[model samples]
Target: MNTSIVGTGVAVPPNVVTNQDLVKIMDTTDEWIRSRTGVRSRRFVDAGTGTSELAAEAALAALADAKLDALSVDAVVCATMTPDRQTPGIAGALAHLVGLSNAVVFDVRQQCAGFLFALDIADMLIATERAATVLVVGAEVHAGYLPWGDAWEIVLGQSTREPSAEERAVATRYRAWSVLFGDGAGAMVLQRGAVHDTAASSGILGSVLHTDGAHANLIEVPGLGSLQRPYADAAQISAGLQHPTMNGSALYRMAVECMPEAVRQVVAKVGLGLADLDLVVAHQANDRILEGVRKRLDVDDAIVPSNIGNWGNTTAATLPILYHELCQTGRVEAGSLVAFTCFGAGAHWGALLYREP
Candidate 1:
């Protein structure tokens, strides 16, 4: 049994936060941000909005593209670090929104590597005949969880409210991770059989997934869980553990070093190489990191499509969003070779190789 992507869609918030606009409230300039992260802007959900809202929008579009009713979807796999709440999973909310009453809904919390992991699981489910169609979604709302302050205020701006005293303490202690993250969502539909059967092009050929829990603490939202002692203390609040924390330099090195190898393994497993690939749709975490992997692999720029400058780091939503854009523009044609790769928190990394049918 083989599973292939039949439809794709992405939903970014209507609100766009540009670097120039950010400078009004933060101490940083547009040039500084662009030079450091290649991010000219990013999107954010409106107040009271959450990950499920974005996921539902993207999922519906994908279902429409597949020419299938939402009720036809057999399963809903939501990949995200930010769920609407800490319980029930975003999948259930999305399933309800999309009207998939019979679908088995669940969530995958692999952070940036989430979409890929969800895809892998969906593939297996389809192959095992558990589902004929699976909808996968990745959504995040980092602004809701980001810390704000004089030192870190420039990176986050004043878009969100100030953290409580406890949240502030967490941010202060974890000041090193106060900046450098953004959010959004992306989605795709994977179905059983050939692409033509599903009214799409190709199917997934092979995939690889790896993780190192030893590095889990290197990047994460630390305080919301029960593990923290003196939980919710003002000091913890100031450190930004209530939100996402990233060890920038360390993360950069890990992604650059881990992703290329993962890509190599996947391509080699499929008896292909960089030269054989038509496009590389990777996790849109950082531009410099993408360039590093490209240089290491010696792949041409044209073979890679990046929307990070416009969308920022969407975590699990990155790959599917890029895939949607490429398909819309006809960059990914039938029979084309496309490679997907990702690396993020949990020191997780993986790759999937596909041939458009």
Candidate 2:
């Protein structure tokens, strides 16, 4: 049995924080942020909401697109780094929210590579007759942990909160990552069937995944894990250990080096080349990283990037959300060859080459 994406749905907070808005609170300007990262603005979830709420919204949209009832989904897989709690996983919560009473539920935690990983699992389960329909959701609520001080605001965005003078100084030094992230959720419904038989009229052909843990520390949150607990310090509290972090330069180099090879391998396995693909949906980490891979692969500039000018990165949700946008706009059609790639914090990377038919 072949497994295919039946539908896709995404949900972003209504709050749009523009670069100009960020500049007022931080030491940085709109030009500096736009030049470094292709972000012009990002969405911030309102207070009191968590990842499950966003995931449920996206899942419902996906179920609607699939033209299937939520109860029909046999399983639910949630890919996220920021779960409502550290345990129980967001999958169970999302399943309940979607009214899938009998569905098996679980979570995948490979960070940004999570959605691709979840899709691969969904594909295998459908191929093996283990599930008739699977709902995969990637959601994150990063605003809960934003560093509110003016020091961190210099590098991070002040859109989440007003900043003080000291916070502005700190923001200046760490502005790169602060301006490059946004929060959102995306979901997809995968069903066991032929592409043309479904509402979407397309299915997945082939997928490839890879991971290298040796460089895991190259980009990661520095505190609050099993290995180290920096909770005792006031500075650590202000820095938000549980939130996302990265070594920008290192991550850029590693992704640029690994992603092209992964793309090449997957495309070759499918007996196609860059020229044959109609769209390339790489992880929305950074514009430079995407361009770097494009240049390395010598792929055309026509490849669409779903990263909106300023949504930053939504990790595992990036590809699926982008795919949903493409589907919504009718940019992808039957028989179109779409390439998907993701590389992230676990130092993990993977690619999939599939035809939309």
Candidate 3:
């Protein structure tokens, strides 16, 4: 049996935080951000909302797209680094929210490459006939990880007062990494079917995944993990150790090398070459990383589409959001050879090939 993605959907908060907006809270300019990350604006969730709510919204939209009801889902696989609680994870809440009572649910944490990992899990279940239908989602609520501190009211539009000098200084210190991410969720509905029928066949054909833990330090969220004796402390939070830090140059080089190589390897596995792929849906990490992948693969600029400029990197939600937009706009069509690729924080990266049904 083959795993076919029957529908796709995305949900992003209405709070559009543009580069100009970041200027008010952090030390940054529109040109400075755009020139580096190719992002002009990004979305942010409201103060009270969590990742599970966003994922459930996306899951419901995907179910509507697939013309399936909540009861039809057999499993729910969510990929997220930001869960509502450390104990129960987001999948169960997601399933409950969507009324997927009969579904087996779980979560996976692969950072930016999360959705790909979640998709692989859903595909495996259907391939084994353990489930005929699955719901895969990637979601993140990154506002908590930013150095908001005393500037929350200013950033969240609750107050008109300007941030203090100290607030701006602290935000600036973490802006390098924090400004690159936004909060959102994307989902897909997959089902089991014949591997590949001659006339109208569409589904995941093959995938190649790789992890290089040797360089995990390139992106580190120093505190707030099981590794720490106490998960999080006021001292750690006050010192800004809770915010994620990154070695951008190192990650850029890693992304360019791994993403295209994974694409080539997986395409070769399916007996197809890079030229056979009509579209390459890559994670919206940064424009530089995407450009490097395009250059190495030697493909036309149009073949690799990106929405990072509009949405920033929505972590795991990038692929499904962009893919859903493409499908809605009539870009991806039947028989189109599509390649999905992503490289994320764990230093996890991968590629999967699919044909539009």
Which candidate gets the maximum TM-score versus the true structure? 3
Write down the worst ten-residue block by lDDT for model 3.
Answer: 193-202
Once model 3 is optimally superposed onto the true structure by TM-score, how far is the C-alpha of residue 247 displaced, in angstroms? 1.0
For all candidates in order, the CA lDDT equals 0.80, 0.79, 0.88
Candidate 2 lDDT over residue span 1-357, tens digit each:
357788899999877878887776567887887777777888878767889999999999999999999889998888998888767689888988889887898999888888888988888888788888999888987776565443333234433555677666655555667777778999999987664465442466677788788888776777665665543566665566555566789898988878788888888886777788788888888788888988998877667464657577878778888888888878888778888888988887888776776
Candidate 1 global lDDT: 0.80
Model 3 accuracy (lDDT, Cα): 0.88
lDDT string for model 1 (232-315, tens) is 677777564577656788899989888888888988887777788898888888888889888877899877677889988888
Instruction: Report backbone clashes per prediction.
Output: 26, 13, 0
| Candidate of highest lDDT | 3
Task: Give the residue spans of candidate 3 off by over 4 A.
Answer: 156-158, 194-201
Compose the digit string of candidate 3's lDDT tens values, residues 123-220: 89998888999999999888878787768778767778899988898888888887788889999999975555554336789999888889888998
Q: What is the C-alpha RMSD of each candidate to the true structure, in Å?
A: 3.9, 3.3, 1.6
The whole-model C-alpha lDDT of candidate 2 against the native structure comes to 0.79
Tell me the lDDT of model 3 at 39: 91
Rate residue 66 of model 2 by lDDT.
90
**Candidate 1 TM-score versus the reference:** 0.89
